[model samples]
Target chain A: MKVGFVTPRYGPEIMGGAESAARMLAEHLQARDGVEVEVFTTCALDHLTWKDELPPGVGELNGVRVRRFPSRAGRSAAFYGLDGRLRLAPREASLQEAERWVQLNGPVVPALVDALTRSDLDVVCFYPYLYYPTVRAIGRVPMPAVLHPAAHDEPALYLPVFGRTFASADALCYHTEAERRLVQQVYPETAATPQLVLGLGVATPPPARRPGGEVLGLGDRPYLVSVGRVDEHKGSVMLARFFAAYKERHPGPLALALVGPVAAEVPAHSDVVVTGVLDEQDKRDVVADALVAVSPSALESFSLVVLEAWTLGVPVMVNGTCGPTREHCEHAGGGLWFTSYEEFEVGLERLLADPGLRRTLGQAGRAYVDRHYRWPVLIDRYLAFLEGVLARGKGRRGSSERADQLARGRRAQALA
Target chain B: MVEERLVAEPEGDHAQELVRRVMAEVHQEAARRRVEGGLQASELAELDELFARHAPVGAKGQRLADVLRHVDARSFVDPVVPVASKKAGGSALKRSIRSATQWYVGFVAHQVSQFAAAVSRALHVVDGELQAIHRELELVAPGPAPVLDLAGTHRVDGWWVAPVLAALDGVPGRVLHGGCGDGWLVEALGQRGCDAYGVDPRVDERTSRVDVRAEDVAEHLRGLAPASLGGVVLSGVLDGMAPAQRHQALEAALAALEEGGLLAIQAATPAAWDRPEAPGEVDLAPGRPLRTVGWEALCRRLEVAAEVREGPAGMDLLVLARARGQGAR
Candidate 1:
């Protein structure tokens, strides 16, 4: 079976949440027999500028062919102004204005749409719903499309354009049940399309030594670690404030290590250390030795860092407001949750004080990862889902024919 | 050592010990204030603290706190006596003043007591009436329906039961012929080695021959027990009900069917009613059949595995077999 992946950006240079997930899946799928995988993406590496870093041509990475198309234009100040105006009152944006907003949102590649419309693959999977590559290109394609919306509760998802994109797909695969519920709440018509909650498979890393206590210039002080992009939206500010308050009350020797891309300013504290974007092995090493890994983000489709920490036999603490992460902790029983500073302090204190409890939670978490997230098992489930999709479309004129009919119905309704 | 161990274990003798101590303290305090005729307000306040601090977890502790705070009965009472003396010169004037004051106090107390009793009775009656109204509203008001566009799924035409009955020729069981319009479908099912009975809103001279009754389909289904029927044939019954009603009827039918029992459903397609040769036998006044996509979505929502067959004659047949160990959803 020939498959195509539609993403805003591709390759190892571009490391975003949905991009990484798509890359991992594309690489793993290429290794399987009887399946030929290709990535159709923009030539841009940076989402900020959407500049054509890579030449507009075909390239090969990890044995999978990739076709890159340069974006027609990058994001603009006018777009930002419009964004601010529309977000104040989301429903006020006109249909034509929303269409223009999709273009100005960047990764606007016309050639990619042309390519997608011309090519007929067995299955074409669109990664993430935020980009023009997905929202615009998806509706134009005639092939059987499976959308990995990676949806969250955001204003953009409610746009009429997105509703049209959701109606055009044959099936949708979500990273978590929370994401699926959000989609259902937003687009009730999607119930006609098949859906599956298949999260990205994490590759099992080989056993590695923990980073020495003195290796990162920390002496004998026990500390908690948070690994992700340090941004206000990602709850870095919240974590910093809570940690400071905890320090003031307890006056402990505990330190907090923040590691990842620094998107927001780190609060200046003697005990808080910000390590921006470490290598994969080094990141794993840091996680292995940490007392507890914290996922403070309240808006995650799936927190890869939490799973990665679990794989290293480290228990995690997640924000209770994050549905996906909290659900993981619930299903795995390998972690705890905190909705406020008081809860955070209590959870951190308990985990830090009790080594036995920490070990029990960590072991449970590792067992969960082994049971549900093994790469081969996940790939098999994906194959089975694909099989189901194919069967549902079989003997009918096409799967999208019904979706198109529904799309037309929606159009009529919109006009009415 | 035993007391310490019990204290460590909250469920042990520590609980009984605490209860005994609280009761002893309460009795001692009550006795210490007996000279004042009744337990003082200060004593009750102290007892409240004791109960709150020593209250065990759960309902017993709550009960203890509530009882201690509301205890109002006193052990002692003041005695009253009538006086009559005729020995002194000013005895008549003093006796007259005392008698008038006593009589006035007694009359006011009696009226106040009577008014309190009346107020209490009125309050009780009002509470009872409010509860009755609440219950009535609960029965009258509808529950929230599932938030899906179920409007289009309830209007299918009913003439398509013929093809469905023709397909169920070899099926065997006690068939519940739902919406047995004019008893034709039930009569057909009777010849197929099945005990067929039907319920419909419209029962006439035709239904006199069979065990058919005039009743709403959803209402009849709701009356049956779980796993009571061998099979259910829903023919044109789902087209004329509201979304919630249709969902309830489907749930009832699924629950009523025995394990491995067959469920044969025939509903009008989107175009069934518009056809020039649409079957004019069954009357579908307010409801229309679900469109193709709408029906598929409804089935998906119901989570029932139905083998759908689209007919060329503006109708669709969905044959389902009840799975074993299927419990109420």
Candidate 2:
């Protein structure tokens, strides 16, 4: 069966969880027996323009066909307020500017439309609902489509319209319960029906000793760790405050490592080491060395960092407010929660003081994650769901007569 | 109080009026469709009998002209009219007028209002068929909660753990299980040397250790001291409450916990409860179905240093610490 995977971002330019998930799914499906997978994504990077030529229309990538359409690179520039040439104005003005720019130079929308019209695929799966162009294009397509809404915030924005549109789709896939609930709340009409529920996969890191090789003050001392984009939403500020409080109570040389892409808006703090944008290897190394992984985000649909921490057999400290993070932590049995600054400080202190508790939570977390969020298990479920959707579609097309006849025969036999 | 009554009555009346108007419109459309189908004299006579049995009764002083006027003005503007026109056009137009006349006579005989009397009669039959279909579908599709309950029981087994050491305001103390559903973790906590007790709402009052009533979570908390209860275990409770009930539970849990008391909150991850239901039955379930809050939002709302932890049993564990100051904001 031919399947088309539509995403706003992909491959070497992979920036977010959804893009990575799409790439992995496409690869796995293509490699599987009796499945032909094709990926259609936007090309936004300039220096890597050669990737655009690698697969012009459709070419093979690890057995799957990949199609790259060059999107307007600076579309996020206005949202980020990076370009000085573009005036910083009202939201409406910025939107107008962004729309004008996309109309003039972007191939994101047209390319999606072209792909939809050109491809003779059985099914199309759209990733991340907020990417307006892809969503709009998917809506226009007459064939059966599946939507994998990767985050809570995106659905919260387009749910009023998307909820109705979703009813027409073959299925809607959600990674986290929080995201699903948000969608259900907005579209109450679709709450009683059972839709697809597929788990998300975490990347497997290479085998390595715990970072600093389990040394005490000499190498690996107890330090609370958090890795993600450094923003207020990520809870970097909260982490900083907690770490400071932790230090005052314990009075150790333990360093709180904050690793990931840094935002200019979220200020850096003393004693909190910010490693901005580490490569994959370095990230793994950091996770291995950290005493405990912390996700302080106040608005995460699902924390990939929590999974990374689990893979490394490290305990996680997660913000309790986010639905997915709490779910992941509790399910894994490998984390602690701190609802307030005082609670965070106390939880951190307990973890720091007790090595046994940290080890226990860490091991439990890894075991929990391996059982549920493992890639192989998740991929199998995803494949089955996709196949089921195709089968359901087949049955929907005038095949009720045979079933009706079978039912009549059963009824007649019962009467006899 | 008088003002409130006066305002509420008018609003209620307006809503009733709207429902009546819509119902009248439906009847008129059905009658027009029937007539358009070119019913013979015998068929018209049968339809008159059908209208007498069906439509909303007692539309006072209704006449054939009034019904015609209502039908011409309102029914023509309806979206269903075009579809009906296409389905049964030429013959239906003639049949519909005849059937409508019969309906008017029936309405006049029944002593209903002229404008809606004919519509009410025709709609009565259509509404019954629609209601029967609705009832049949409901029987086929039993509510999702019972199924969820079964699935939840099987999936949530053997995934319990006693929190290593319960802390209250940076001080260690014995943890008590105030309300442990299923005893999965209560048993685990008992083994771990924490003073854990199983409190089941379902258990016989004589046998149960603690009678944990849904309404008395606060009263239950009154048994513990300000800084004595190290941790409160609320598993699968908050998500199962109405909004007001959830608020009460949270408030009670916060109030009961000591300053800096650890609240080990494990809820069914939103992902587990994320499946979309069919349209129109979203709120039919008694309690909220697990996907109550995002982890971040819950942490933020609870106003504690929060971490989203994964339990060994694949349940989302929120190990929240009580704020040292007052309860959660």
Candidate 3:
């Protein structure tokens, strides 16, 4: 069966959560028997600008066919202002204002949308539920569309636009049960859609015992490491403030290591170390040697880094506010979660003071990753879901015609 | 099964109303089709048998059931029996009188049968209306809790744990099984990799779990800070509490719960509450168990969303959470 993927950004260099998930799913599906996989995405690597980087049109990436479309415009300050207003009061926004919001949200590729709407693929999967390419294209497409919403409890998801988008899809795939519940809470009708909680699969990292502190230029000191973009949204600011307070209160020998893209201001502290983007090997080593890997993001669908930490047999600390992270911790029993400074201090103290506890948690995490998130297991579920879509598609022969009628009606209404 | 909050305005309410309207339209269409199909199989069979007994030549000479299939059962007629003798031995007036009496009896019987058919149709329509009303009421106010007797069996199977854990992800703390009757739920949670403990006003020595303690729920909740506890399960505990006490417990549970922490309330159906003979914990409560409507109203008043699900055995589970922006409505 031929399957296609629609995403905002596509490429090996793109490190965004949805982008990475799309890539892994595509690759895994491509490797399967009797499954033909392809990807349709924008010719841009950066999410902020949506600028044209790769040449537009057809190409190949990692043995899968790729079709890239150039965006008409990049994002701007005007877009942010409009988005902020729209998010605050979406119900009040006029049709014209809603259209403008989508336009300015960038990666506004007419060609990609046209392809998605016109494609005859057996199944087209749209990743995450943000961005113009997904939000706009999903409604217009007449195929058996599957949405992997990667939903979190956030303001943007509650916007009026997503309800229609969710309704238009034939099925939904979720990374976690919490994400599924969030989707159901926002759009109750989506509960009727065929949904499966098939989390994105990650490969087990090769065992490398290289000294992490020496490779990442950090001195031999017990520390808590967070591997992701150092942004306020990812709870970097909160972690920084808490670490500073903890350091001042106890004067401990431990440090806070922030690794990944430096997108936010890092709190100035003598013990805090900011490593901006490490190579794959260095990242593995750092996670393996860290006292405890921390995921502070509250808006995560699934923290891939947490799984990576578990794969490397390391204990983790996650923000309890993030459903997916906390769920992973709860189900795996491989980590602890902290909601406040007090909780954070206690969890940190326990992991730091007791080596046995850390080992037990880390081992449990490794077992969970191996048992549930193996690539083969995920691929099998993916195939079954697609087949189910095909079986359900039999009764949906007139849906395309119905979709066309609805589109025409909407266009006529918009013009008037 | 999950209880989801219906969003306000921006067409959220309109969407639900529209769905209900469409469903009513679909139902009307189905009923219309059924009516157009004439008599159903059972009615047709009865009419065919009636014809077979009366029309001997037609019934015996041909396939009577097959012939009757094309005929409307309601319009089928029984053949008039030849009763009066035509011999001119006695008085001609006597034969005439006998024929008139026979005709009168047949006419009276036909009228009564027709009247019965009309009443049946009217009764069917009334029954349909009653069912529709019941369905609407069920949607607005959750139907009575199922009659589940959890008094004797303290089986703490973690069936409700998945949804509760999903709701409790926002807070970081041990799960508090508020009315930990038999310590089974708390033990199940601990086995499922959660830091959980039970609290109750009374404790049983035969309980298998060791984390439970004898403590009042209100007292335990007062000591916790806002958004401190991850989840609090009120399994049949709220039913026994006074209305004001229950209200206060709800306030504390909401306060102690993080933005998305779970407040799981499981209870028996109204049948248990109404039945004096039924031996159950729900019967011990002074007031009625909370229905879907009251449950939703309470959540709305507290500025939270409650999702409710009813089980087969009259057990209802309510999962509650605080909405975004904290009281945006």
Candidate 4:
């Protein structure tokens, strides 16, 4: 059976959590038997600018088909003006205003939406729900639609318009149970929607015992690594600040390595190193020898880096407010979490001091990853979930048809 | 208050114990620091208050459950209509007309208000029922601490496993044993040439058997494709359930079984449960033993061929039902 994925941006170079998850799912699912995976996305590479970097057209990537449609406009100045007003009181906005809010959060790719409507795919999966492509194109498609909301407890999730977006799906796939709870709590009607908390799969990185400190220029001073785009939303600034404070409290050789593309203004500190963008091999190598892999993002649906670190037998310290990461720590026995600077300082001190605790937690985390997040295990569940969705969709259609028939018969009898 | 050990070396693959230990130590340190004023008490209180306010965003005591509560509390719909207009003597004239038609208008308005109030009440019922269903579904959904944690450590065997296996000997598809903790009975069923799996609300993480799911048995049964299972063995499930839960389990089990399939339930007699030797867990379970006569009546109500067999000296009872091959609607 064939399934299509719809996302605003798509590519290998894109670094957003949801986009990376979509690409990984597409690639892995393509390898599965009796399943064909296709991607319906825009030609954008950068999320912030929404520039049409990649050429638009159907192309093949690793044997899977990709259809990239050029966007109509980039992120506009007017969007920020409107966004500022809406974020203050999103639930109170009028329906028209909500629609405008979605449209203004742009990459407004009409051609991509049109392609999705005209396509004959049996099922369509829309990733990371808060986008023009997903909000506009989800329920409008002819085939059964599955929405992967990847929602957080942010103000945007409380917007009046998302209730309908969530309700329109034939099913939903969530990255974590925390995500599922958050979405359903806001839109309670979705409790009835057929869903699977199918968290994204994590492929085990290649076993390479390369020295990580040398690669990141740390040179054996035990460093804490934060992998991913250095963005304010992902808590890069907060983490950097906390690290500097910790350094002042306990002066030592412990370095902080922010190893990803820099997008946020992380203040320059002597101990904190921002290795602007590394290759995948270098990133893994850096993570492999880290004292602790810190995922500072408070809004992660599923922090993939934590799983990657676990796959390398490294413990993690997460932002306590983020449900998915805290859940990862609790479930895997993999790490600890901190909600404040004080908690962060104390937690970091404990981790830096205890080698035995670190190894035990790290090994537990590895076991947890192996038990659940392997590509084959997650993809098999996903494929089965897709089949279940198809069956449920048929059932819904049959029931609606019967209801239609009954209504028509009643109307005809009244006329007679 | 900081604990000595944060994380213990896991015995083989059981690291959850270590996680618990570590979390304890962390919380302990936080508590000690707060008491000793390393971080000011005022600051800690403010932080705790902030976390407490925002932590349960979509959790219980939140919006979905309370959506209709506003209506419930203020269900009285206003029925007043304006009587004044800005014209010479218009106010007096309108008042006079209103007074003349007051009885009829008031009666009609009251009826309409009551109708609105009734609709709100019905909506409240529907909303409440939906929330209840959501909670029940959540009991089995794949989340952290997925199990319901109601099942106890006291296990029963030796009396019913053989009979259940014999009853379901040649069953031709997947067989499910509900409340199969640690999966001893499921293994016995497997050894008896049946493709059996188990589901228990209390799951042992280190069990090594992937087929044993951590979920509510009734909810698990409901999730299956209709008429899919060849046989069903319900052991140690019904004795502690409320009446509605018991009925739901029975219905789900019967619905899941294919036509001509076997349905077996092994339960203890009330005499055994009420005896002083019994564990008396579940805060005195409400649906204990369901009496042999009640089981027979329940079988009859379900409308399937069945037999009720009392164990030696009336310690337990087994009810076996053969499905008439009905659809799973």
Please write out the lDDT profile of model 3 over residues A139-194, one tens digit for every residue. Answer: 67767888889777765676666666766677778888668656765564453355
Computed on C-alphas against the true complex, the DockQ of each candidate is: 0.02, 0.01, 0.01, 0.10
By TM-score, the best candidate is 4
TM-score of chain A of 4: 0.93
Global lDDT scores for all candidate models:
0.66, 0.52, 0.67, 0.72
Tens digit per residue, CA lDDT, model 3, B253-322: 7655544566787764565456555555354344566666777777777777777775544544455555
- Between prediction 2 and prediction 4, the one with superior TM-score is 4
| Over 4 Å off, model 4 | A393-416, B1-13, B39-280, B283-329
Mind giving the per-residue lDDT tens digits that candidate 1 earns over A254-319?
Answer: 888898889888679988988888887778777888899999886788888898888888988887
lDDT of 2 by residue, B134-153 (tens): 78998755332211221142
The window of 10 residues in a row where model 4 chain B has the poorest summed lDDT is B144-153
Q: What local lDDT score does residue A375 receive in model 1, on the 0 to 100 scale?
A: 81
User: Each model's number of backbone clashes?
Assistant: 4, 77, 6, 1
Local accuracy of candidate 2 as per-residue lDDT tens digits, A61-156:
667777767553324434334223332222223444544433333334476677675778888888766554454565555566777767554212
Q: In model 2 chain A, which range of ten residues has the least summed lDDT?
A: A394-403
Fnat for every candidate: 0.00, 0.00, 0.00, 0.17
Candidate order by DockQ, decreasing, is 4, 1, 2, 3
Q: Rank the candidates by lDDT, best first.
A: 4, 3, 1, 2
How many angstroms is residue A132 displaced in model 1 relative to the true structure, after the best TM-score fit?
1.1
Clashing pairs in 4: B259-B325
